[model samples]
Target: MQRQTLRLLSSTASIVFSVLATQASAQMFNSVQLHAAAPGQSGGMLGVAALSTPEYQGSAKNRKLIVPVVDYQWANGWFAGGSNGLGYNFSGDPKFHYGVRMTGDIGRKEKRAKLLRGLGDIDAKPEIGAFFTFNPGADTYFASSVRYGAGNDNKGMLFDLSAGFTESWNRNLSAGASLGASYANDNYMQSFFGISQVQSARSSHKIYTPKAGLKNTYVSAFVSYMINDRTSLSLIVTSDRLAGDAKSSPLSEKTRTSSIVAAAAYHF
Candidate 1:
């Protein structure tokens, strides 16, 4: 269980924005997820965390949030909670997992900041997707996932890919780092980065339409300390840079930014 606890730290070391997802669209996450726990060794976590993020994806503003942290898995491979969403673990191999999941997007709201005056609200949407993860060694992991059903028409799609490495300095101190990328489809790009003519007329910016392509690249690192078997404390830092369409879009204010997060989690 101590080893499993450290794995969780590697999985979330790079989240800079929200308590739930790594990326803004469809609640995308780092390559490693909450599904890699040893099978039948089911356990759960309950905690709270604070998030510091840009007012929107590209705005030059920031906002803070207090979010709940909850995650759990059953002995039968069924899991639910923050990054895991509600998914089933089907991989027969103990070193990896592949399954389907239901996740959601916390769409952007224009009213969140003054910079978004003309842009309309983007309604949150439920999503369906697949996840695949592989651990080549006890300390190395590769992960990828794709989700659909975001945006106003619910036709947006996003693909996230990542890899991670972990280490244990001692029985009570652990650390990990990860690298990842994100891709957006036409609908998803247009909804968030592109502005229509009608929208241009209403907003401060001109009409700009961006095609689908690579959206961002990021890296994350973390250090965690175990207070005891059931409790742990962590400090996570993540940095991301916009690329391709997301970078060229007029909506992008700061192309590169970083996030810092601290949390305490308990295992049961």
Candidate 2:
């Protein structure tokens, strides 16, 4: 266990350094400009976190801080952009994950204007993008993810569609809920659901499979408060359900679990 923990830490640190180096050398394109209406236009965010789950319970502790960088450019009414994010969780259970995403717009300025007008009454605008994720602990408890989104408000997919809404009562209070489903690889499913092989030495059984299905469907809720313009706190809870052959695992009896996360984010 100690060796495994150390390995996880070392891998995470390597990924962080690589990402930082890449960002430091990144150059802005001629067409790129900051969004006038969005925060973090310079496209970077740093945060500290404390997260807890029923599986690992303890006080909030120090977690690695991170800054995500985004760059955007536009030409002939079309837009292109890319973003990179890094974060770490270090407390009861130590973990780190990061990824990059790219996006493109396929409409003319007039089309964009029409779309914005249609969504003006709505609180959220629609976006489409693809993302890739990496998890070094694929053989262990952590499973990485790569996903894509389309349609209005990042919704509408036959297998991985998701939809949600968020509202802020004031600068310090806000809440939102989301529901989504996706088809995942068996190994990834197993990792997320905490399924593993058990060995019984006395029984002479070389290996035994736990009876439980891996979870696939995900539901989540979140609330956040902004202490100030550059600093804010937030909490998130998520639940997942197992699916297919994975549900047959003995450990699948308890198909639901929740996690509570508290985080503070800063912009630079």
Candidate 3:
């Protein structure tokens, strides 16, 4: 089992605005989403975390990420800092909230692969875009987002679509499940999955180029329990598999990627 535990500090501040009013209550949403975490509250937090993932998207080697978690948000809909990048919510309705955000794209860095020599490296970059969330009822929601690369590392865009439903198992415990798919553009496909003639001359695999298409499909389930007025715990399990040209890439391990995350959070 992969687990992480930490203590988070949360604080809230009040700001007067002429055009906006703050809601009195904050609702917890999906924190382990594929595209973005749950809607944030007007507060701040700090914690320790551990994440298990493939060294690259398809490599068999697993790397465990142990890092500090920090986040902050303002009541005016502006947020910054964290693994999810930064963005602001400018508009919404009873059923939806519209916002824009960005995330870091940790590109490929593989070593010890004789077949990958001279393929160089795909530098880490930032992906920025907008999103919308639809709350159909008390127990169900849907979300979609599109982000484009903002750095020189890669110049492709990505689209993410997802849906989820939650069940209240008890007064303090709840469980939710989500399904999602991500699509990539030709530049992204070619950058990550396609093999060029220059690369082929230096590797064991033949040269190949891939077209834009669905990159992966995934499902995740999580259970969260409120420990007290200021604390909570959550466990998430996720699995994903490559699709389209991503699955057929010579560099792909073609195995399903799975991860387990356990989180403890505090609210103010």
> Cα RMSD (Å) between model 3 and the true structure?
9.1
List model 2 lDDT by residue over 1-268, tens digit each: 3332222222222222222222221100101111211221223344544544322101022122244423222221222223222211111112332223232211111122221222112122233233322223322222233333322234321123344444555545666655554553443233222223331332222332332232245566666665655455666665555455445443234445444455555433
* Candidate 3 global CA lDDT score: 0.56
Ranking by TM-score: 1, 3, 2
How high is each candidate's TM-score?
0.92, 0.42, 0.78
Off by over 4 Å in 2: 1-40, 54-159, 186-215, 251-253
> All models: lDDT?
0.73, 0.33, 0.56
Residue-level lDDT for 152 in candidate 1:
75
On TM-score, who's better, 2 or 3?
Answer: 3
Q: Global CA lDDT of candidate 1, please?
A: 0.73
Best by lDDT: 1
Q: Where in model 1 is the C-alpha error above 4 Å?
A: 1-5, 8-27, 30-32, 35-37
Q: Which candidate wins on TM-score?
A: 1
Clash number for model 2? 14
